[model samples]
Every structure is written in structure tokens, then in C-alpha cells.
Target: MFDLSKEFESFYKNKVVLPNDKQNDLREKKNLNISRLKDGLNEYNEENKTDYKIINTIVQGSMAMHTVVQNDSNDYDIDVAIIFEKENLNDKGPLAVRNIVTNALKRKCENFKKEPEVKTNCVRIEYQDGYHVDFAIYRRYKKENESEYTYEHAGSEWTLRDPKAINNWFKDEIKDKGQCLRKVIRFSKMFCKSRDYWVNMPGGLIQTVLCDEKIQNSYERIDEIFYHTMVEVKNRLDNDINVYNPTDTSLSLLSTKDHEKKVENFKNKLNDKLKKLDVLFESDCDKSKAKNAWYEFFNHDYWKEDTSNEKVQKYSSCYRNTEEFIEDLVNINEQYYVTVSCNVEANGFRLQPIKKLLRSLPKGWLPHGFSIKFNVEDTNVPKPYNIWWKVRNVGEIAQKRDMIRGQIEKHVGNCKQEHSDFFGNHYVECYIIKDNVCVAIDHIDVPIE
Candidate 1:
């Protein structure tokens, strides 16, 4: 496929994936909205002489699933579930409950140019800067005093729903299926949302369901997997546009005529793009042509744009004196999927996962000098496999210090311990060999600040 792996990784990292700064901003905005909602509800209760109170609030949807992509319009959406005790509401209809939440938002969030409005299923508060929050109201009541509480969402009628069901479903898929699926879903979303012309396109949840249903996992690079997965999903959609909820098969996510129209449009467009990628399978296809094909598919220049001078300089500095290639030292077979994760420890105290710490900090980096223990967290390969570890360090500090370690070594256990000695985008890769053939592989990059 012309090996556009580097290009795809760069595009996904720089364009499709939301930056850490944007993620932090979204989290702050969501937190502010929640605070306002709760405070407004309190004000509503005091002014109306009512006892309405919020029992629970949960962030759901794409934000909760961590599949949110960078959009051109900056139109980020946050879905939250606002739950209350049914007895507190005294038997209110769906619209009535929505109205209460809308009024509460109106009372506290007066800065919005567009006021909080009650939708059929949620109360939406739109910010002037293009961010919106959807609060899905739900009520819980005990059928019998001794029985557990039953949850019902305030839809047209009170419909049974577990607010966390969809999120849990995606989590389970990631846990069992593979992490690559999450990246595929994000890339598909980026493609579907690349241009604003397709206004009727399926939303993130629907798109996620589609990807889950027709995902194509492979040992090939992520770019290839995404291309084939999009084709598979389009074929599936052509067969049927009805997308059932992953949490509940009985409920269809595409319940409206507009949703069906959106899926049809998406399927047709994807078909057209997949036809453009036919050049990829040709023997004469080269890197430039393959990337251009991807550009055509995504309708984005990220695929076609030349590497920036800054990136070139960064790469030159990192690799100017590097002589080791991990692949040259070991046989690499990606047949069985494996995932590696690490724990950051300081002063004998295990703090948190390295990736989690990096996401919480700026620039996807961690403090130097922390001890790291990388573990083979998940794998589908059978037991009795040989494990190999490689720690590669890059950056001016590492290069000047004469510590650019890139050796592949056999490890004694599933966990490999190392310390952050200097600044660099250091990474640890684990290779699993079964019967002298590398069966699975995974790597986790740890950027030292």
C-alpha cells in the first residue's frame, strides 16, 4: 500500500486527534456548565419554593468515550446525563422535565447568545463560541420500596435507559477487541465530518456503532486498516441503514427519517472515496500518490502537505547520530494484537499510568527522573512466548550525553523497569515471540519534559 504509515501517524496526531490544550479547554467548559446547572437548580428550587434536587450527573457520549476529533468549526459537543429521584419530580412528563432543566440553565447561564432550549430528548445550552452541552434528563424510581431503583430517560415518553451503557459498551470493545478500533472510529469521524456539505451525516454515536459493526482489523498499518474498514462499513450500510444501539439491540439509533437519509448520504460518499483509493492497491503506487489519495478521501490538506521545516529539523536532530533500528535486531510479527502500558513511580510511590499522566500534563510529557515499569497489559496470543524489550531515546540531551540507547534485549518478565534519565521522546516496545516467530508487538512512547 506504498507504506504511508508515517504520513498517517503524523496526520492523525497533528490534525484528527484533538490536542491536549483543546482537551483541557473542553474539560473546563464541561465542568463550568455542570456547576452552573447545579447552582441554577438550587436557585430554581429556592425561588419556586420546590424541593427539586439533582441526584446524579454523568458525562456521556463521545467525550466520555474519548473519541472526539478535531473539527474545523470548533463545534465541540458534550453530552451529560442529569438524573433525579422520580419522587422529587412528583410524576412529570418528559417535556415538563426538560423545561425545568432549561429554565435552570437559563437562570444561571445568561451569557449565552442562544438561550438554553428544550429538545425532544435533551436540554441544550449553546455557547457563542460554538460549543454546546446536551443534558439528557432521567429519573429513577423504585417499583417497590424493597426493589432496586429503575432508571427511565425523559424522551417522548419515559424510556428505560442506562446512561452508562453505551460508554461501557465501547470500553468493553476497547478492552477485548483492540485499541486500534478507537483510532479507526476517530479517523472515520474525521472523514465523515471533513466537509460541512454533508449536513445530514450520522453523528458520532451512530458512526461509532457503524464502525463497531463493520470494523476491519489487520496486521497492516493503521492507515490501511482505516481504508479497508471504511469500505467495509460502507458496504454494511448499503445493505442496511438501520443502526441498532450497541447497549440495546431492540432500540435503533437511526430512528428518524433524517437519520436514515444521513446514513445513505454517508454510504454513497464513502463508496465514491473508496473508488478513489483503488490506486493504492496498484503496484506502481508510491508514497506521494498514496498520500494524495488519502487527501482526496479525507478532503483535508494534512495528507498532502509537505512536512514542516520545524518537523524536519526535529527529525534531523533526533536521528542524525542514531545507528540502531529495533526491527533489524528482532523478528516482528503483528499477527496477534498486544498492548503495553506503564506505571510512573516516584519515591517508591506508584503515581499513575504514564499515558494518563502525559495526557494530564502539557505537551504529552512527563517529568524526568521518574521510574517507569512498562507492562504487557493486554494480548490475545497464547502463553509460553518469549518477550523482548527495547528502549529508544531521542533528543539533544540524550544525543549529547552519549545515551541514545536503542538496543533490543530479552526481558525476564512481562514488566521492564527503566528510569527517565534525560529529556527526549523515549519509547519502550515489547515484542512477543512464540515458537521463534514474533507473534505480537506493542510500544508505548514516553515523552520526557
Candidate 2:
């Protein structure tokens, strides 16, 4: 491909990434608004004789991940997680809690052009400028005999969500690789949000996940790496549009109808744009053609200028060979999905659901003699299919004790029972095989602390 590494880098700095000055200004604005919220709530408490207290605040979304890009419309969305004690809510439902927070935000802010509105999941305050702040209200409480606190968001219902899970996942990714992946994510976001006509593009978190999965950094030039990575992402989406959350595999990021449509739109548009860039890899491609291709792709004016006269190198895409897992060996035709749930018991006394314990307990620890029973709750697949289960244990203790059991076994029924003997990040996967092809599959994590 024509070497546009210099051009890509320049465009990234001048157009794609947010400027340092703007970043600083946004930070100041965010801090000021947060302070106003806290003060307003305090005043509300004093007058109403209520004891609502702010336990913690967390910054999430693209801003926390540092993958924010410049927008043509100058519209910015800032997310802040506001945590409160469970007693403060007094058993109020989701909408009531949101209204309480919205009333608090509307108390004494002079700069607000409009009053704060209560959405389904958050309280939104819009400024005179294009910036809007969303305060996601959550309640925290410690379970009995557990050291860690459980956080649940006041959405349509009380939904369990770890406020720092996705942020920590992205931070770990950056630590393992480097800033190059962040840059690639920014470039991908710029392309996704380039045109005004394109509606319902995938949001920053989904884009970040896609880039993290498909990024190829072996190439020296940034342009070449981005091109190949985007192509790989497009190809993957062509088969399956479902995107599972990395931290919690059971949670689907595209759970809603709107989000599913958004990803479908992104996949189609990305395929069309990547086809135009195929000319760059031709034998007789030059700088002018390459510049036009990228300029049209990003729809940016900075890409119009050409500052390099470097020779074009023959583009040979290099892809890393990932180890094939057992699931990859099968012809996965996921026409349906199976729901897996676990039952927990200690000394013949039943406890809560294992899924709930997994969220509340920090390390997914169970008592010494606890037994677990995994049941296939629901499935739409036809009858007479083979049921297979696999238990994989992973941890330092499991490795040191030589107890890392990871074998697939065939079972006769829908329920499988096992005892928790060691502490590790163990998991069980269930697969439904029909006519020598996997028709449905599901897995549940069993972390032992």
C-alpha cells in the first residue's frame, strides 16, 4: 500500500484525537458540575430532613478510557456514576430514585438553561453549550458475611452492574499492549462518526471492544494496521452481530433492539468504506489515490494536504495465528441460545443463586463443603441433541496443586453436579450438538476465592 503513515499520524493529531486544551477544559467543567450536584444534594438534605448521602462517584464511558474523539457538531456526553447507600433510597423503585436525583440537581444551578430531566436510567442536565451530563444513580450494600459491597444501578429495575468493570478491562488492555491500540480505537471512532447522514452507529464502548479484538499491530505504518484491522472486524461482524461483554461473558452488549440495529448499521457501512480502500493495495497505487481514499473515508479536510513524497511499499498483510480452542474446532451454527443457571448448597442447606453470589463476592468464593449444580434452564433447540459439558479450572493454586481439570464430557441429562474442592477461576460450558454441528452453547463462571 502507499505509505501514508505520516499523513495518518498528522490527521490523527490535528483532527481525530481531542486537543489537550479542550480536554483540560472538559475536565474542569466536569469537576465543577460534580461539585454543584453534591452541594445541591446537601442542601436538599438539610431542608427536607432526609439523610441521603453520597457514598462514591465513578467516571465511566469513553472519557474514562481516553478514547474520546473530536466531533463535528461539538456535542459531548459525560457520564458520572453517583453511588448512595441502599437505606437512603428507602425501597423506592427505579423511576422514583431517578426523580429524586433530578430534583436534587435542579435545586440551585444558575448556569442551566433547562431544568434537569429524569430519564429511565439517569438524570440528565444540559448546559447552554452542547455538553450534557448524565448521573447514573446506584445503590451500594454489603451482603451478609461478605467483605465486598454490591452495587446495583436504578435502571428500569434494580440491575446489577459493576461501575468499574469495563473501565478496568480497557485499562488492562492498554497496560498489556500500549498507546498504539488507543490511537487505533480513536481512528476507528472517527470513521464511524464521520458523516452526518449515517445514523445509529455503534457507541464508543462497542467500537473499543471491536478494535481491541481485531487490531493488528505487526505492520510498521499506522495506516496499514488500521486498514487490516478494520477489514478483520468487518469480516467477523458479517457472521454474527452479537457482542458479549468481555468482563461478564453472559451479558450481551447488544441486548436492546436499538443497539442491535446500531451494530448492523455499523457493519454495513464499514464494509462499504473498506471496499473503497482496496485500491491502495493495488500494484500501481500512488499517494494521490491513497489520500483521496482516506479523505473520503474520514470526510476530513486535513487529509486533503499531501506532505510526503515517500516511496510506496508492497503491502502484505500479516495476521497472527491464534491458538484454536475446542469451540473453534466445531462448526458453530448458533441458531439459538441456551440459558444456564447454577444452584448452590452447603451441608444440604440451599443458598442464593450462584450467579448472584458471583457478583457480590469479590473472588467468587464459596464455603468449604459447598456443592454446585449447573442446570440448563431454557433452550429452543429441537429434541434428541447431544448435551456436553466442560469444566475448566484456572489459577495459581490450581496450577501449583496440579488440579487444573479441563475435559469435555458427555452427560445424559440437562443437570450436572460438582463439588467445589479448590479455589480458582473455574467455569463450566454447556454445548448442544445436533447432526455433528453445534447448535447452541452457553457458559457460566465459577470463581473461587
Candidate 3:
């Protein structure tokens, strides 16, 4: 059987997992919001004299499970359960408890960019920086010789829920299956993020169910495991089957409106991904092809190779060569004739003054700045050669001030920096370096005031 386990594993480690710095940043932001919520709730309780009080706050969801993927857009969603002490909850009702938490958050975080909003189960606090926290309000109480947590729903009223139990179940599954379970879940979440139809899919709950039923081992090839899981999930959704919360038997996880359309879209997208995966794993030597397939599957730029370092290296080499070539050319072709002119209105430096080179600036004019254009007047020099510009300070003091130095494609180049500081003669040199040898050179003394 064809296998791309090594490639998938590398991709998971390099691309699927969130970087430490990003994870820390998300954690720090989440903690800050949690602190704000706690302070706000405490002040609210003291001021209002309401018996409703937050007893505990617990971090739940994919964030707590470490299954989150790196989101370059900073759109991270964190889940927190704000457990309240059960007192007069039956009389106050679930809506009342949810509203209390929402009001407290709004009062505390009045300065936040986005106002706190109420969802079916949680009070969402959205930050301007692209991260949001969902505070699920739950009332905890001892009833019938057991402690239970109750969450609110829009039309159904209070429903039995144990976020801690659900979190424990995920944790236990991860433990039993090893880190592979976590990796698989993260990959699935990333897959969802890649496609538009899957973006609104219930990622966390679906991942949990798949881990429990589909994935059998930690050592299985990731592409194989992911494909199988996708097929199974698509099948279940196509059949209109309900996925139940492992912790609460009565709670159905798939409760989105227009379930049939969602399932159809999901199946279509899943087939596309499966086809790509097939091409990816079918060949071991064509890693680039596989990477492209994966990129198409996810539709994210994070899968692309980072060429920043390569660009820096190339520019550095070109810069060094230009400098050395200019030095050599200046020494060899001292007799070469080149003309340099400056135009203030056009903001250009002209060499061999073309008609376009406006002579609007008077000599010694240095107020608005100018560009330096240079062309080789020598006919012996070959055509289509590279040109470089170098500026040096030459006065009685003879101190070399910093100047903008770069290679120009044509015979014309611009001085990126203005000559405003000194009123003296500066040497502007242009050179043509051919085959690692300086073939022609020209120099002009530019007066700057």
C-alpha cells in the first residue's frame, strides 16, 4: 500500500500545531479576559446584592484539549465555563442566569471593541484583536444525592450538562490513543478551516466522535486515518444520523439548521479532499506535488514554503557584488565620460539628459531632493550590461556619509535619500560590471546644499 505517513507527520508537526508564541499569546489574552470577567462579576454581586455568584471558572473545549491549529488571522475562539452557585435558580430561570453573566461582562468590559453578545449557551466577548471568548453560564447544584451542572438553551429551557465530564472524556481518549488523537483532531480542524462549507461544521464534537469510533491506532498513517475518518463522517451526515455528546447521552451534537444541505455540501467537499489525498499518497518521490495537493485541500498559505530567507540571501549577494564591482570599475575606467543631472519638479536624476529629463532645478538646488541617472557614453562597451550606482562623501572633512546604494536596471537611477545636511561636493559614480569584471565606469562631482 502507498504511504505518506512521514510527510503527513512532518506537516502536522510543522503546520498543524500552533506555534508556542501564538499559543502563549492566545493564552495571555484569554487569561486577561477571564480576569476581567471575574472582577466584573465580583463587583456586580457586591453592588447588586444578588444571591447569584460565580463559584468557579473552568477552561473547556478544543483550547483546553490542545487541539487548536494556528490561525494566522488571529481568529481564535476560546471556551470557558462560568459555574455559578445554585441558589434560587429554579425561580430565576436559565435566561435570568445567562443575562446576569452577560450584564456583568458588559459592565466590566465596556471598553472592549465589540460589545458582549448572548448566544444560545454562552455570553461571547469579542475583542478587537480577532480573538473571542465564549463564557458558558452553568448553574451547579447538589440534587438527588449528586452534583449536576445545568446549561441553558433558547427554547428548551435548562438542560443537564457536565462540561467537566465532557472534557474528561476527551482527555481520557487522548491518553488512551496517545498524541495521535490530538494530532488527528487538529488536522481535522485545519481541514474544516480550509473549506467554506466545512467552516461552520461542529469541529470539536465531530472530532471527538471520530476519535472514539473511527481511529483505531496512533501509528496509522495520518493520510489513511484522515481519509477514513472523513468518509465515515460524511456517511453519517449523509444518512442524517445524530452524533450524541459522549458525556451527555441526551444531547445531540449535530443540531444546525438545514442539516440536509450541510451534509450534501460536506460530502462534496469530502470527495474533493479524498481525490487530492489519493494523488498525494500515490507517489512518494513527488513531494512537491503532494504539498500542492495538500495546499489545494486546505486552501491556506501556511502550507507554502517560507522563501523570506532565500530572498534575503539573494539580495545580500547582489548587494555585495554591486559594491565590489563599482569599486573595481571606478578604478579601471577613469577616462569614461558620464553626465549626471538633477530635476526637482520631476524628482528624477538624469544621465545623458533625455528630453523627459526636465532641467527645472537650478544648479546647487537641494531643497526638494533629486535622482541620479547614469549611462555609458562609451561605444566599445557591449549592450545589455548591469549598472550600479554608488555615492560617497568627499569634502575637506572627507567623512563618508550613508547613501542609498542599489543596482539600477536601465541607465537611470534615483537617489532615495535627500541631500539636505551638507553643502559640499559629493562624488557619484556609476559602473558596468560584466563577467565579474568592471568593464566601464563614470564619475561626476555632485554639489549639494
Candidate topping lDDT: 1
The sequence of per-residue lDDT tens digits that candidate 2 reaches over residues 87-155 is 877988888888878777888567676898888888988888788888998998999999998999999
Model 2 misses residue 288 by how many Å? 1.4
- Looking at model 2, the pairs that clash are none
Task: Decide which is better by lDDT, 1 or 3.
Answer: 1
How far residue 152's Cα lies from its native spot in candidate 3, in Å, is 7.5
Task: Please give the CA lDDT of all the candidate structures.
Answer: 0.79, 0.76, 0.59
User: For each candidate, what TM-score against the reference?
Assistant: 0.71, 0.67, 0.61
The lDDT ranking, best first, is: 1, 2, 3
Off by over 4 Å in 1: 145-147, 308-449
> RMSD of model 1, in Å?
10.1
- Candidate 3: Cα lDDT at 399: 27
lDDT of 1 by residue, 1-449 (tens): 66787677767766877754466567667768888989999999999999888887777878777778996367899888999999899998889989988888898887786899989889998888888899999998888665777889999999999886776687667665576777888898988888878677788988888888777786568887888788889888878889998888988988889888989999999988888898998999987788789888898977766654697556545533343333334333334557788889887546789877777777777887798888888887898887887777776788666677766787567889999878887777677877665556566778888
Question: What are the RMSDs of all candidates, in order?
Answer: 10.1, 18.2, 21.6
Among all windows of 10 consecutive residues in model 3, the one with the lowest summed lDDT is 328-337
For candidate 3, lDDT tens digit of each residue in 1-449? Answer: 24557657657655777754465466666667777877777777788875555666667777666677864357788888777666645456767777777777777786676788878778898878888899887766676766644543322377667757766677567556655666667777777677544554555666567556666464367777776766666666666556677877687666765543444555667766767666654546365666677777777775565534787445433322221223212222211123334323334443323234324445533442444444444434455555566655434333233232323333344232234346555555555654433444444555555
